[model samples]
Target: MSALPDSRYVSLTTFRRSGVAVPTPVWAAPDGGDLVVWTRADSGKVKRLRHTSRVTVAPCDVRGNLQGEAVEAQARLLPPGEWQPALAALARRYGWQWRITYGAGRLVGILRRRERRALIRISPA
Candidate 1:
């Protein structure tokens, strides 16, 4: 499935145990038949994905506001071997802006001793 447009900011909604959804806006890029995204490892989305693959995604603006209807999807954390490649794909799709922002995010993560961010792949459910 085409998971939004290649360079769209998608609102990724991950579910809580009680079935409530928590949404966050994220930059995503097409990765073969799936979509790839990178986010802080400790984020709520990652935590929820660990518990369940159930997720919904939709085109959105930078503030997590939805601009389209959500579609069902499943997400998985990608293997470490693919992290760099996934990031490269994102850069190719988003250009220098992504390169700068992603690079800086990594730098800040290191400086803050934060958990390293994770790369995820999302596919149609």
Candidate 2:
């Protein structure tokens, strides 16, 4: 298979106990030669990720049209601090509103409650 895009919003698919949950339009960052994603710690995605680390991330166009190779990678939960900087950088690059929110710990808490970020180490699978 061909290589995936370096950085872009991707549709992340994870398996939940109830069924499969597909979270679309998630921001992913290329860090330490891997792709990382952040989500609520208590999110169903997190729960699903715990059971299976394998995941698929695909790129989408302006109209939310998917294209390119869907990356298959191994996922692992990252400590909050471990991925915060990268996440912040991505937010700034994408003009997201999280940078200002990070200044306030309470706001961060409110925003990230039950949210656990994960790093997906991409490689030929």
**Best model per TM-score:** 1
Q: For residues 1-125, could you state the per-residue lDDT of candidate 1 as single tens digits? A: 54444448998889999999898899898877778998888888889999999988898899977788888999999988878778888988899999888889889988998757888888988
Measured by C-alpha RMSD in angstroms, how accurate is candidate 1? 2.0
Estimated TM-score for each candidate: 0.87, 0.67
Cα lDDT, model 2, residue 50: 81
What is the per-residue lDDT of model 2 for residues 1-125, given as tens digits with 9 covering 90 to 100? 54545656766666566666564556665665666665556676677778877677678664446776677766777765576666655666556455553335346666867333344433324
- Best candidate, lDDT-wise? 1
Compared with the true structure, all predictions reach lDDT values of 0.85, 0.60
| Pairs of residues at least 3 apart in sequence or in different chains that clash in candidate 2 | 40-114, 40-115, 40-116, 41-114, 41-115, 41-116, 42-114
lDDT of 1 at 53: 97
Model 2 CA deviation exceeding 4 Å by range: 17-23, 62-64, 88-92, 100-124
TM-score of 1: 0.87
What are the clashing pairs of model 1?
A: none
Worst 10 residues of 1 by lDDT: 1-10
List all candidate RMSDs to the true structure.
2.0, 3.9
